[model samples]
Target: MAFSADELRVLRRALAVALHPAPLHDEDVQDALLLAASVDEAVREAGRLRAFLLADLARYREALPGSLSGYLELLRDALAAGYDPQADDLAALRALRRNPAASELLARCRILAERSVRARLARVSQATATSAPTGPRARLFALPGGRAADDEPKPNPPAPAERPVPKPSEVFPPRRRPVPPPPPEERAAG
Candidate 1:
């Protein structure tokens, strides 16, 4: 219904060729076809762009809510474009309740969000219960500098079997300090 000036001109020329019995320039026909192809390409690109925008908006909405992001605007666009809300989308809409239409969406998403949570909890419990011992389960000592000690490869256990195990006395000899006797309680310095 909405034709650009160039499109209208092309259409007029075509109509002229159709109505008036004359050989219109072959280049003009090709030009009109090319313009139509370009228009179709533009439309396809716009659709792809919209899809990308919608996907990004959903991702951002699902992420932890932070400072004023363009979530609401994206949501508005998505809703106008008839995007189905996911659990995260519902949660986001719930948080951003200024829009009246959000109430309906929130209600619809409540069950979805609950199911999502239950599924997550179920997965966590399953993992905890069924996880096989991954390389000796023990209370591992953490390393200095906040790194996990176990994560680092252990210094290749002294390759030779004759790794001289140092005796306790040799490794950590006792320290004998002379303890000075305390002065007689302030020597009755009444």
Candidate 2:
């Protein structure tokens, strides 16, 4: 999807601020917020490009003889078809516009589709690399990589400990007893 000049300028500014070492600085905070906003814009652009591509491809399919086989060939050589969008995907878009061998609108549409796919891929990759993991461990504890305040130690109150109680068994002593047996009964029986 094409970025408006203003949006591109904003992206550039945000990127610069985010990459700066002093994130705690006021400018850095503003930069971070701008970057977050840009993310939503990027998503919207991607959606727009996806719709445009699909519509173009449908048009191409209806117009050409052996168009299905031609698309299959394009798929097989898709990587060679091009993925880079140097200085924006202008060159690739131009190439699409020039293809008289195929339906002009359909070819352009496919180009738009490829460009959208590539743009989204790049954005997702960038986001994944920068964003913290949303796993259980990340949720339970703050890591060093988090914001500056996350590194600060929290204050905790000291606990009061009580003395342990002594057991009754420890203070008591054993009593001695005299034993009497069955000697008298045995003598009587005998």
The lDDT leader among the candidates is: 1
User: Which portions of model 2 show Cα errors greater than 4 Å?
Assistant: 1-23, 65-190
Candidate 1: global Cα-lDDT?
A: 0.71
Candidate 1 structure quality by residue, lDDT tens digits, 9-53: 887887888899687688887977987787798889889988898
**Local accuracy of candidate 2 as per-residue lDDT tens digits, 1-190:** 4666765766676677669744465765675577667777888987776566545544544444446455434423332444232222233334444455334534554676678778899999999988966666633675565787666786565555544576776667566576766698797998
Per-residue lDDT for 133 in model 1?
A: 70
Candidate 1: where is the Cα deviation over 4 Å? 1-3, 12-24, 67-69, 81-88, 95-190
**What does the lDDT come to for candidate 2?**
0.56
If scored against the real structure, what TM-score would every candidate get?
Answer: 0.40, 0.27
